[model samples]
Target: MISLEKDAGLWIVTIDRQDKANSLTPQMLEQLCEIAESAREAQALILTGAGRVFSAGADLEAARAGLATSPLWERLSGAIARLPGLTVAALNGTAAGGALGMVLACDLRLAVPEAKLFYPVMKLGFLPQPSDPVRLTALIGPARAKMILMAGQKIPVEEAQLWGLIDRLAPPDSLLAEARALCADTLGASPAHAAAIKAMIR
Candidate 1:
């Protein structure tokens, strides 16, 4: 399930499938992709999940049915990356598998202190979304990216921060609040000014 909330220029998208550890279904992924693609009006976009695990990646049954290799994963991440606004991944908990694609695409990443990030595509015999490795390598470096994608290491929050994988670590209970606070300046800026700065940085 996906929950999208719009407050002025800020967009908050949440994955709301707690029972499934917030794993995404094809429909939910489509909703996310649509939201990302249509969020040109958003000055700041914060993506989060509703439970302890941000996402366990694709829904188990769906992944077994070929969802793991779907082009939707690449489409979703590409849409998020193209958003002309500040895009933040507010990781409430562990982020694994295909979920890492969107996280890597985000402009900034804020994670709970207890959160960990990993992608098991190698072990699962599936290649990651097309853009994931380039983005991940850009943030943390090719060697470190290899450690996670190739060696299958689960990167803890502190280690992640050290490697520049996550920009900040927030208290678990206040993760969203902190993520919102991080967007205050962007939220207050003119849409054109915000978009200009984002484009300049990229």
Candidate 2:
């Protein structure tokens, strides 16, 4: 469900479920958590998804089956979100539901031109994790975060960037490459200094 590659002191994590728009499965999330744990020693980390989407969010069928709230998913997501290193998200396509939460947790996000983001917990008749609102507000400000949560509206890629939701933009095909380049630039600096900077920010 996921692939990990290492190059130039960076770890690239990819969700490889194109047939399902790279939707998050419990198992996939577990693997991602493991990847993030292992990334602690790396200079940087980048996550993306296969095919046209970085992630479409949770598997709805799993939710209907009562598997979405499993403890494993919660633990795994927390591990990925708090990975102790420079973390970057390569938003390769539309990111919604829990996927938006994942992107919001990253230190930096490079979104593709085709990327769109939304928080539709209201529309789904479900509330997002309480911490999501905090992270969303930290990323895009309280006003934008409340608008997304309350209105259940989708924000286009450009608008999301303008709203401070994403740090940079890349072509769909080049999103991963851009992410790698950004990580490379990060790794080019002194690792110790970077770690110190990250610690200070945290």
Candidate 3:
């Protein structure tokens, strides 16, 4: 399930199927894309999870049924990337498979100390969505991106931080608070101003 909370100019989106490690179904993925597309008026947006694991990627059944290679993953990530708001990935936990696409598109990524980062597309016999590798490489470099994308190695939060995959680490209890704090300035600024700064970096 995807839950979106709007607070004036700030929007927070959470994947809430905790019983399944937030594994995404096709409907859930579509919901996320719709939310991201509609959030252009938000001054800041935070994408996170409801439980310990941010997302285990696609639901097992869905992936096995051809959802793994769906273009919705690309559409969702692209919508987030095109947002005029400052987008933040508040990784409450590990992000695997297609789940990493949105995180890679975010303007900033802050994860809990225990979160692990990996994309097992290589092992799963599927190539990652189009922009994923390029954004990942832009953040952590080509070799490091290869370590995860090609080797399917899991990088703990500490190593992720060192390698630039994670911009900061927040304790579990304080994760959302830290995200809101990080968005404070963006929320206070005009949407145009925030978008301008974000675009300058792009």
Measured by lDDT, the strongest candidate is 3
**Model 2 ranges off by over 4 Å:** 70-74
Order the candidates by lDDT, highest first.
3, 1, 2
Q: Residue 44 in model 3: shift from native, Å?
A: 0.4
Alpha-carbon runs more than 4 Å astray in model 3: none
* Residue-wise C-alpha lDDT for candidate 1, range 71-102, written one tens digit per residue: 99999999999988899999999999999899
Candidate 1, TM-score vs. the true structure? 0.98
Residue 15 alpha-carbon offset, candidate 1, angstroms: 0.3
Model 3 TM: 0.98
TM-scores, all models, native as reference: 0.98, 0.91, 0.98
Residue 157, candidate 2: Cα error in Å is 0.9
Total clashes, candidate 3? 0
lDDT tens digits, residues 142-199, model 3? 9999999999999999999999989999999999999999999988888888888988
Task: Looking at model 1, report the run of 10 residues with the lowest lDDT sum.
Answer: 121-130
User: What local distance difference test score does each model get?
Assistant: 0.93, 0.79, 0.94
